[model samples]
Target: MMAALRRRDFLFGSSLLLASPFFMRAARAASPRIISLDYGLAQTLIEFGTPPVGLIDTPGWYDWVMEPPLPPGIANVGSNYEINMEMLQLLQPDLIISTPYLEWIRPQLETIAPVKSFPIHAVGSSPYPHIIAATLELGQIVGQPQQAQALIDRTERDLLAAKAATRRLAEQKLAIMTFMDARNIRVYGPGGIFQDVLDRLELQNAWTRRTNEWGFSDAGLADLIGIGDSRIFYMDPVPADVLAGLAGSPLWQAMPFVQKGHAQRMASVLMFGALPSVSRFARLLAEVKV
Candidate 1:
């Protein structure tokens, strides 16, 4: 009777061990090495503490995402739109995360492993909700749901704090731009994440022109006169030639923001990234001198 009781207890203990959280985590750690084809998704994966084994264009990460630098050992699998298939097979990833725009290459990626496409951009709506939903889904996929929630919570708090700290700029009527060339700039406005951040911060976006799906419009230097007394915050890494040309152009020097010293350049930040990008933008705004 004692021997039978001990055997029964042993079996129960074994079953509990198999179903334990540590066991589940170990099982996950051993399988499903992930590769991300989208930078935004890669950012999400890393933020949730489950970095992908590989991603696209690792070199450009410094110039764009800048914050949360890419961890070493992540393979650079070449271009985002078209990845190196042979290299991908060499990595032997169990899962590949991409965006809806890359559906064209899904069949190719599926040949190596299961491919999952997530979207943070919608044509006619703010992308903040979509970004949140994508982060949650990706966290669930990587078995880090709790970590993902923590990141979301932290981001919300940081953004709220940034908003309160930046209330002084509400009446400043800011125009965010990036130099496209000597005479042209891309002004950010409605339908873009920057605009969404501005809305959350209770600030105004001076660009009201028609924007593409990504939420920026191409305009000439003189066209900015329409914004009327708005401060211009341009992104950094402006091309050397564009700077030289602007310096020489009478029209560029004549801009109200330039003459008033309201045109300032900010550190590089990814305009197309996920939640981290939103938080980073807010933090940058809080640091704004205006």
Candidate 2:
């Protein structure tokens, strides 16, 4: 009887030991390896301390948005519009995230792993809420839902604080424009990213016309004169030489806003769709006197 009991006990112990890993695996959460195809999502992930293992287009030209550079060891999958399938497959990511604008590429990426695409610039959407929703969704997908909520809360608090700081000058009319290239300039009008920021501060946008798909309208220097006495905020980098050239231009010098000292050059904050970019804009607003 004692010998039989001993044998049964040993067998039971062996079985439990063999099943331990499976049980633990069932209870233990898995950390998903994600590939981020959107710059905004990538910025959110970095804030969450889980920088993507791979990214799409990361260029050095935009320093105001992704200052300090991407974390080392993160591979570039391809440009924003064109993702390299071969490299993406080799990375073996468990999930892929992208913007809704990139929906055409979803079918190809789905072959590798599950893909989630949200509209980065949804029509008639409030930028703040939309971005918070995106971040929360991303966190849930990556098994970090709590972290996402915390980040959203923090960002809102910061934004609110910034807005309050500028409330005294809320009536100031502000215009944000960027150079499309050397020859033409584009101004952020209704429904633009900067427009959202301006609305939050209750600042009037000098440009009231509808923008193109990219949220800007091409215009000559003369078009800016319509703002009358409003402040003009230029949102592109103007090198010293370019500034000198503009100073030399008769049309630029004769602009009513420039003559009245209402023309100001704002640092080129990344106007592209992203939270980090918006944060930069908020900071800039906080620093400006009017």
Each candidate's lDDT (Cα)?
0.79, 0.69
> 159 in model 1: Cα distance from truth in Å?
0.8
* Stretches of candidate 1 exceeding 4 Å from the true structure: 1-31
lDDT of 1 by residue, 1-290 (tens): 65454334333322433443323433444324789987888888888777989889998898788867789999989896668898899987767888887888888888887777777774567878888988877766655667779989988998999999998889789999888887788898887789989999999987888888777888888899888778888897788898777768888788887888878888877877888888999999999976
Identify the leading candidate in terms of TM-score: 1
Tens-place lDDT digits, model 2, residues 1-290:
65454334333322322343322221232444678887778888887777888887666426445532478788889986678999898987766878777888788988887676767574554456677778877665544667778886776676787788877556667778876544467888655567777776667777877687556788876787787777887765764555667778887788878898888888777665566667668768878875
Query: Model 1, poorest ten-residue lDDT window?
Result: 13-22
Tell me the lDDT of model 2 at 264.
82
Report, for all candidates in order, the number of backbone clashes.
Answer: 0, 0
- What's the TM-score of every candidate structure? 0.88, 0.81
In candidate 1 the C-alpha lDDT for residue 18 amounts to: 47
